[model samples]
Structures are given as structure tokens and as C-alpha cells.
Target: MNTRDWNETLRSLNVGLPDDVERLKAAGYYEEAIARIDAYLAEDWTKTQNSPYSQGLCPHMDVQPENPTPHGVDVLRDAMIAQREIMRRIPAEYTWSKADAIAEMQRRVKDFTPEEFEMLDRENRMDWRFVEGEKRYQNRFASTLIATHADLARRQIDPPAQPDSEKERCRRLHEKMAEQGSASARITLKASVGMSDEAFAAALAKAKAEGRDAVHVRAWLPLPAACLSQSDIELEEFTEEPTVIAPENAPQRTVCWEADLTENRSFGVQYSYRNTAVYTDPFDTPSAPEQPDFDTEEQPSHIVFTPYIKALAAQLTAGITDPMEKAKRIYDYVTLNVRYHYQPSYFIHESLPEHCARDRRGDCGIMSVTFITLCRAAGIPARWQSGLYVTPDEVGCHDWAMFYVAPKGWLYADCSFGASMARRGDETLRQHYFGNLDPDRMVANSVFAAPFTPPMLGFRADPCDNQTGEVEADGVGLYGDETVSSKELVQYIEE
Candidate 1:
């Protein structure tokens, strides 16, 4: 059928009973239960009409009105009466909207094809009595179908239907990072304490251009610890430095959690969009990946990513027609919004959007999720890439996204590292990370919650999604190493 015809058919088919049926009972029209029951059965028929059943012995024999069976009439009668009873059990305010109903419908059935729409239409308009089951059954089937479809849709990310060349492209990039310095070359992170923004920016720019893999940062003046005691320090932006802060007379007591020592570690700070809590994890990577059951129908779509995510993706794509530009948009948005919130590697994979949303902070894992959500919402296919962060100095579990943008195909975007580069005055990280990924990075888990292809020696499964981390060679925690921050390195050297 043409689009117009299809639209009409869909509308007519969806003319089921109102989502809130209690209103019918309130109006003293208890008999309306029959119509509501019929509407639901009609919807089921339309949704499942194209079944590959026998041409002779149809399962829904009553659906064919000319050959009406006494059994079909009894089924519809029983279902209606049961629905009336169900209404009494629930509160009066309960209701599902039309949109909610459609969403519900999609989730209920797998392998539900377009042809079923025609069947449901015919069944509802003609053999309305053929619908079977009681009131409880009616709700169960409908609820199950709707919930399942939503869950499936949430987990499924439709990558652009391109060729397999994307995989090869990623491999080449990995090789580049693999060969960056001597295979055993040690990475050094040097930083300047108490520097101004302009000066820090200039220093970072020099480091970046000279291939001097180091980050430029200023002291968290006063200190990073005062927040625990709720110290009232006036923070001001310094044109020359990172920030000019006036410290209160309160003693500069050290809060174990507040020390900026995390700066010397691999990943930098983390942040979230929904909450105001910030933390730092000293491990190189966040956590190991965890696998979730694939059967559930309710998935993390509307709840995890806020509406602002969609707007951010659109904003990033403005005027930038190139695939690289689109990638840049994705990269920039994440670094700009999500800051570093760190926890122990053991806890990284367990709580994701929950921790990030409630606390408003996360390490790379959270950043990756936020970035992936925005890209998917904008119709850009993105997936997780988790593996050891193999820097020149150390290796630890790290996380990032592989986005498929037009022309560029698939590329990695590491927002945390890219954001650090931006902070240090290197615009290239912000610009290249979107469509262009770092060749220095290697991917471990190409698919989240699934076993890695070709596997690994003694490869262990992730207990949850986004659980990726690393330990020292001796089997201890030490995420990966970030030898890029200048301010952090200065402190490290002094110690």
C-alpha cells in the first residue's frame, strides 16, 4: 500500500478501546467492557495476521466470520466479563496513552511482520467475537509484547549498512598507536603547578606540537580536598592561569578522597549531566565489562539519556557536513559536558547511568555511554570498544566508542583524553577525535556484554555492560597510565 493508504490502515487498526477503560465503568456503562475487549482482540489479530499457519485448519477459526463457531462467541464473552472484573481491582486513575499503547504493542511480539496488520484489521472489523481469553489474559499478552519490543529496540544499534572495510580501518588505526614510541618506551606526564590559563594553554600547545605527550594543568588552588568539609572558597577564572581562588581561614586538612593525586593516573576527571557529585578513581581503567540477559523487553533508552542528548548531537552536526566534522561534534559534546568521576575499578561496571545520573560524574565508561547515547539518538551508529589502555608506559582497561559516520565509516572517540587535550590548549584532540580516532589505542571488547571474537588467553566474561578495566602484571589494580598531564607530572616528580 502507498504511504497514505498505510497511514489510514494503521489509524483504523489502532482504533482500539481507550487506554483508560475505567472511565467507561465510571459512566455507568459497564457493558462498554465488551467493546474494549473486542478492540484489544482486534489489535492482536492485526498484529499477528500474517502468521504462516495451515491454509485449511486455521488456529483462529472464528476469525473467519462466515464459518462462525459457538466456541469463538463463548471466548469473547468470557474475556469481556473478566475485563470488567479487573477494572474494579485497579485504582481509577490508571491509564495508558495512545503512544504508550503503540510502544507497548511493538514490545509484545517478536517476528511481528507488517502483514499481521491486515489480519488484525479484518478480525476486529469482521469477526470481533473470535477473540479469546479472560481479562487477565488480555493484559498479560499486550503487556508482554509491548515490553519485549521496547527492550529489543533499546539494545539494538543499527549501524550503517556499509561493507566490512570499517573493521580494517580500525585495525590500521590500532597499529599506528601500537607503534607510537618504542614498544617499551616509558610515557612521562609533566605538569606545572599554579599556572594561569593562557600560560598553561601555551605550554600544552607546545607539548602537543613537539609530540611531547604531556598535559598542562594548574594547581587545584587551595586544594582538591576542601569540598568534603564544605569549605567556602571563592573560585574565580584567571585569564593567565586555570583559576584564581581565595581560600578561607579553615585549616587545609587533607581529605583522602579530595587529593588531586588522581591527576597523575591514566584517566582524568569525570562528570555527569543529571547530578552534582564528583569523584576520582586511581585505577587506570574503570571496571570490567558485564553481560546482561538478552531476554528482557524493557531497556535503557528514555531513562538513561536525557532529551538534552539529542539536542547536543544535532548541535554538534551544525554546518559540519563532513563525517569527520560529525565525529568532532560527538567528541566535543562529551568532553564539554561529562567530567571525570572516578571509583575503584571493581565498582566501575556495576552501576552506570544510575551512578552517573545520580552523582553527575563518571570516568571514561560514563563518558563513553553519554557519547554513544547522543550519537544513536542522532541516528549515528555507535558502539563500545573496551580493552587495555596500552600507552607507551602502562596497560589497563579503558573504554571508548566506535562511531560510524559517513565517509569516515567507523572511528574511535575518547572524550576524556580528548577533553584533557583541549584543556592543555591542543585543539587537535577535540577536532580529530570525533571522526578520527586515536591510532595509539587498542580495542578489547568490540561488542558489549558479548564474548570477544577470537577470544583471548584465559579471557573472562564481563559481569555487566561497560565493565572494562585492567590490573598490573602481578594481578593488582592500576588502571592504565596517562602520561599527558603536565601539572600532575610536576607533583609526581616532586614526590
Candidate 2:
């Protein structure tokens, strides 16, 4: 299946599980739910006419081409994903039982009591869910609770110490940029140029299926792309020659390779890029008479302007007409309101922005998407940009937003960083993120939910963003559980 068709099919399918399947799974009858899904698909497979399941046939199931019923296939796929989610992701993430949570909390908090745990649970500060009629707490619940609850954070026996060296570096960088001039005098200032070299590796774990020793494996790993703040990208080295390297301008850029695997084989690449920090104060610049409509419309499946989104946007931007102010309002709403929490995977989410807004919990990408959606709904042009937060100390996937104001053009918004600053009680730096970004970024993608140049025939592990990497074996996609990836900072030089 081509990229466009796959995306359309994903958008067309309903997000929620089938009623009977959901009921069975909720009741802990997982096997029964799987059986029911298989039965439904088998029935649909035999249908010759007058079947709703056969109406929209997608020939990309990665299964038998003769059985190309997307409705049933998608239902089965969703069911399997749910099964993996509950059995693998949820269990692995939420590893604490009631007793375990209590023990861990008491160890961390000198005078911790069961009553405090109950209170935290009541306040919904501890992330937990019922699994098989028993409550399971998230593995990071204690740390998260302490981080978010100020009083708890103060009372801890040994409070977790956060590293501030990076923050100070960013503050100094912003200060240097701010010294240039006011936004009215200089609409955009790019300073603190830095060059970085990084190496990344990805490999598929040996498949568990019988007699699959020689499976044909394919992989796609991200590579830096040129953007306003990022440039001078060079693919320096590779462990093995890649089959294809995406165009420099591809929105979701990647280097692709294929190999027949007799044993576990790692594919690696080394790349260098130069990133420049950007700063702009929208408050200092007057709004243009006419702002461009680019990126002001909805992007479906994630950035759609549903009724709830429209209502929320209207409420947030009520009586506010300035485009830059509207964007700032949206950014402030997300950063101040939403709590950061680790997510399972983007493929599992039906609408990321709506999920973040409704749940009030999301990671960096979710917050960015929510901010982008609200900005667009408020008649402001906003878009997605993400890759890695490549610092000398560490390398990890990160995402942020960009909004276009007429005179200032595209200003950056790192809602996650702003929220972090809020948690740390640093209003100065929190506000800085609304219109500025540091030089410690490697941008590989400028568009959200974009397809690859040579698209994968099977489903992608993350359909929304390609951060780490993706792999497929013998035409079947592999989830994160079936793969391992690593990113290493090779070198960094301040210019």
C-alpha cells in the first residue's frame, strides 16, 4: 500500500474497539476477544457481497492478498494492538502493585503514610489503572508525584536532584540573543551557532516465529534535514551502505536499508549538522494587517478541529484578535494546564491533541500537537517540528511547535520546556520558550504525520513521527518491543 492510501485508511477507521471485543477484553477474556476478532475476520473473508466490511478494501494487510477487507482487518489489527498494549506496554510501564507502591513511597518519604497515598490517588497525581480488577501504579508514580506536588517534593528524605547545567546554558544563549535588540528593531535573531556529530544504530531482535532464520529485514532511521534553525547537514559515515537516503527536503527524512538476517545485525549511521538558536519577542512587534493562511487549516487524524477543539479554542482566544496573542494564549494554555506523562506510542492514539486536552496529560509531542491544533483553530498558522534534543550530555527524541506571525514570521514554542520551567518556578525562562529555542536541537521533520519518501508497505511503528527508527521483517512491521535502537553523541563544538 502507498503512503497516501494507508493514511486515508487510518483516518477512516473508527478509533474505539468493537463493542463486544471491548467488553470481552475489559472482562479479562483476552483470548476470547482475540478469538472473536478472528471469527469476524474469517466471516468477512468469505463474504462475496453485501458486507459493510468489504466496502473499503485496503490491500495492505501484509497478509493474503485475496483477503483484502480493511474493515475486518483493521478491527483485528486494533484488537491485537490492544492485546499487546495491555499485556506488554501497560504491565511493563505500571509495574507497581498496591503493596509495592507503598513500600517505594515509604522508602523515599521518611514519614510517608498510607493516608498520603490515598490522598495522592484521590488527587489523581499518581497514575494508575485497574488491570484484572486490581490497581497497578505507574513505575514512575512516586517520582512524578513528588515532582508535581510541591509539598511532597519538599518533604522527601532525599529529593531527586535535577541537573541545571543545561538550563543555565540555554539561559545564557537566550540572553546573548536578547542583547541583539527588541523584536520591533530586529524581528528574528539567530545566534549561538553550534555544530554536532551524532551516531545512531537500530536492529531488529530475532523473531520468535519458527524457521524464520533468514527473514528479510528492512529499516529506516532518521537523518537531519535543513531548516531555518538547522543547516549544514552532512551524512558522514554508515556501517553499511543504505539502499536509499531521502531527499534533503523530505518532511520526514530517513536513510533506508535492507538485509537478509541470519542473526541479529545492527545498521548504523553517523551525521553532522549545525544548529542556530533563535529568539523573537512577539509582544514587541505589532501584528501585521494580514497574516498568511498557511498551516491554519486542519490536518486530519491528529490536528482536526473537532467541536470540542473549536469550543476550547474559542474560549481560550475569546475577545483576543491579535494572531501572535492568539498563538501565545494557546501555548500558555497547554504549557500551564497539561501535565507531562510518558505515552505508549503514537499509533495507538486516535487523536493526539484531543487526547492531551481532555486528559490533561501528555509528553512533549502531545503537548506540541495540542498547541498546534489550538493555534490553527484560532486562525493562526502553526506547524510541527521535531527530531532530537542533541546536547553534549545526552541525546533523546524531542518535539516542539512553530507559529507564524506576519512580521515575526515563524516563532518557536517549546511548551514542554515551558511546563518544566513552570514546575521549577522559573517564569523568566518559561516565557522565553514562547518565542525562542536553544541551539541543542536536530530537526529531521517539519511536518506532522507525514509519510516517508519510500513508504513502508506494512504499518509503521509510529505513524505520527519517526524519531528513533522503524523496522520490518519479511514485509511485516515490527513494533518497538521487537527492536532495539540507540543514539550516541559523537562530537559537539560551539561556534
Candidate 3:
């Protein structure tokens, strides 16, 4: 299948499971569910033929009538995908038994009891699901419980402290930029000084790909692009010569390579870039009479304006007219209300912002998308910006947002960081993130849910954002279990 066909198939997986298959799976009859799905796939149902599974498979599934009609095919495919997702979610995600969870909690909370655990479970403070007729909790349930529940946080003993150096770095950067008046003024005054030069090496582990018997393997690794805050990008080296390197300003930039399995099983790229910090106090700038309509409209798949989102936006921005103020309110709502939780792959989520808003739990990218969606719904222009959070001590995937407000131009919002600040009771730093960003970033994507330059023929590991990397073998996508990604910060220099 071509890229378009594969993309359609990926979207069709979101149609949901057929009723019978769903019921079977929910009752812990996994093997029976698989058998029913296989039986469905084996049937030949034409458009003229009436079958219990034919209706509501897909909106356009009735247009074509082959031996096995489009509706039958779509249903079969959706059922198979659902089965695979169910299996994938069990062993890795829901691993902790009740005793295991309580034992782990006791390590952190003094005299933790089964009764307390039951109460927390009743309040839905922990993430748990049924697996093989037994209740199992997620691996991070204890941490999430403490993070979200105030009483648990207070009862916890000796939580790890945030490094003072990190706090000082943020404070120094903010003070230096605020002294320069505005983001633009800060950029101009620093020009070449107070910039961070970072080098990162990303690789797909060879050991993970060693046993697969495939003729060809293809890979794409993120490369830093030229943006307002990032520049002087250099694609210094690669394990093998790249087949294509995306243009500097590509929304989702990547360095791509293809090789025979016999020749190479792993791929890697080493690159470096310079990032300058920019700070804008939205309160200090006066808004222009007219604002551009850019990024102020809904973008489907994730950044959509559903009724709940619209109502929430209306309530947040009620009795307020200034775009900047509306944007700040949206930011505050996300940072203060949403608790950070590690998520599964983005491919599994149908609507990120909606899920986050309703569940009140999400990771960095989810919170960023939620902020962007709410901002657009409130008539503020907001967009996505993500890649890596590179610091002197650590390097990892990260995401944040950017909003436009007339005369102030574009500003930044890192809701995840702001939420951390709120938890720490640092109001000043929490407010600082509303319009400013640190220089410890590497930006490779400027748009959300954008296709790669040379699109992958199979489904992407993460269709929404490219952060870690993507790899495919023989037109089949390899997920995190089949692939290993590593990021090492080679150099960090302050200029």
C-alpha cells in the first residue's frame, strides 16, 4: 500500500471494535475474541449481503462492493487492530498486582495500609485495569497517586528534591531576558552571548533489530531546524550517508536513510545546534488593534473544537476580551488542573486534547496540545513546538507551545513545566512560563500531526509528533518494543 492508503488504514483503526469482539475481550475471553475476529475476516460479505457486522464499520465502507466488501474488510481490520492493542496494553502497562502496588506504596508512605489503598482506588487515584480476569495497576500508579493526591503527597516521606542548580538556571535566564525588555529586545541584545550550544547523538540499538529477517530497513531521525530561537544547525555525522535531509524550515524535519538488512541493522545521527532564550512579559506589551487569523482555527484529529472544549473555553474566557488575557487564562487552567502522567503512544489516542481535558491527566505533549486547542477556541493563535529538552545534565524528548498576540508577536508556554512549578508553590516561575522559554531546547517540529518529508510507507510509531525516531522493516512499522532509541548529550557550552 502507498502512504495515503496506509494512512487511511491507520485512521480506520479508530472506528472501534465490533460489539461481539469487544464483549468477548472485556470478559477475558481473549482467545475466543481472536477466533471470532478471524471468522469475521474469513467470511465473504458483498454489499447486497446482510451481515450483523456490516453496518457502522466505516463511513465510506459501503461505496465499493467486492467479494469481501469494503465494510467487511474495514470491520475485520478494526477488530484485528483492537485485539493487538489489547494485548499490547496488558503486560507492559498493567503489571502491578494489588499486593505489589501496596508493597511499593509502603516503601514511600509511612505505615501505608490496605484500607488506604482501597480508599485511593475508590477515589480513582490510581490507574488500573482488568487483565485475564484479575485487576492489575500500571507501573507508575504509585508515583501518579502521590503526584495527584494532596494527602498522599503530604504523607510521602523524603521525596527527591529538585536540584537547586536547575532552579537557579531558570531564574538567571528569566532575569537576564526580563532586563532586556522583550523577547525581541533580548534576542538583539544577547545577539551572540548567553546562547547554549548543544550536541546530541540519537541511535536505534542494533541488538533490538538483530533477529528480524528482513531484506531492507529504513529509518528517520529528527534533525534540528532553523527557528526564531534555534540556529546554526549542523548535521555533523551519521552512521551511514543519508538518502535525504529535509529542508531547514520543514515543519517536521528528519534525516532519512535506507539500507539492506544484511548491510546494517542500526542507524544513528549526531548533530549540534545553538539555542537562545527569549522572554516576553505579555502584561508589559500592549495588544495591536487587529490580530492575524493564523493558527486560530481548529485542526482535526487532535486539535479539534468539540462541544466540551468549546464550552470550557467559553467559561474560561468569560467576561474577558483581551486576547492575551484569554490566552493566559487558558494556560492557567491547563497547568493548574491537569496532573502529569506518562502516556502510551500517541497513535493510540483519538483526540489528545479532549482526552486530557476530560481525564484531567496527561504528559507534556498532551498538555501542550490542550493549551493550543483551548487558545484557538478562545480566538488566540497558537501552534506546536517540540523536539528535545537538552540540559547540561540530561537529554530527553519534550514538547511545548507558542502563541501569537498581535503586537507582542509570538510567545511561549510550557504547561508541563508550569504545572511542576505550581506543585512546587513557585508562582513567579509558573507565571514566567506563560510567555517565555529557556534556551535548553532543540526544535525539530513546528507543526502537530504533520507527515514526514518522505513519508513512511507503513504506519508511524507516532503519527502526531516525531521525537525519538521511527524505523520500518520491509514495509512494516516497528514499535517501541521492537526498537530501542537512545539520546546522549555530547556537549553543552554556554556562550
Off by over 4 Å in 1: 1-308, 314-324, 344-360, 437-440, 451-462, 465-495
Write one digit per residue (lDDT tens) for candidate 1, span 1-495.
111111111112112234545456445344565467566544534333444342344475445433334223443434343343333322221233334433444554455444543453343211111112212112233432332234433433342244444334334443443355211112222212232344334445665686755543222211221321122222222213222222222122110111122123332221111101112111223222332222212123211344455465677787754544455566666676554544323211323543443444456767776666666655556766653343333334467766664333345677766665554465643544553444233232444433211111111212222223211111111212311222221111100
What local lDDT score does residue 153 receive in model 2, on the 0 to 100 scale?
74
- Among these predictions, the greatest lDDT belongs to 3
Q: Which scores higher on lDDT, 2 or 3?
A: 3
How many clashes (backbone atoms < 3 Å, residues ≥3 apart in a chain or on different chains) does model 2 have? 0
The residue ranges of model 3 lying beyond 4 angstroms of the native Cα positions read 1-17, 21-43, 47-91, 107-110, 146-165, 181-214, 263-265
Least accurate 10 contiguous residues by lDDT in model 2: 186-195
Local distance difference test, per candidate?
0.37, 0.74, 0.76
Q: Which 10 consecutive positions of candidate 1 have the poorest summed lDDT?
A: 271-280
TM-score of 3: 0.81
Q: Give residue 233's error in model 2 in angstroms.
A: 0.8
Model 3 agreement with the true structure over 1-495: per-residue lDDT tens digits:
344425434444445577987787676556677777777766656643754336645454454544645446664485465445545445566778999899999999887899999998887667666777778887788888777767877888877675557667677767777886432111111000000111011112332365644345678888888999987777777877888999999999988887764333466777877888766678887788788898988776578888999999999999988899999999999999988887767765678999889988898999999999999998889999999887776777899999999898999999999998888788988999998888888889999978777887666778889888887666666665556677777777765
* Model 2, span 238-325: residue lDDT tens: 8888899999889999888888765556677888878877567779979999989989888766898988899999999999889888
The clash numbers for all candidates, in the given order, read: 52, 0, 0
Model 2: residues with Cα > 4 Å off, grouped in runs: 1-9, 13-17, 22-31, 45-95, 107-109, 150-164, 180-213
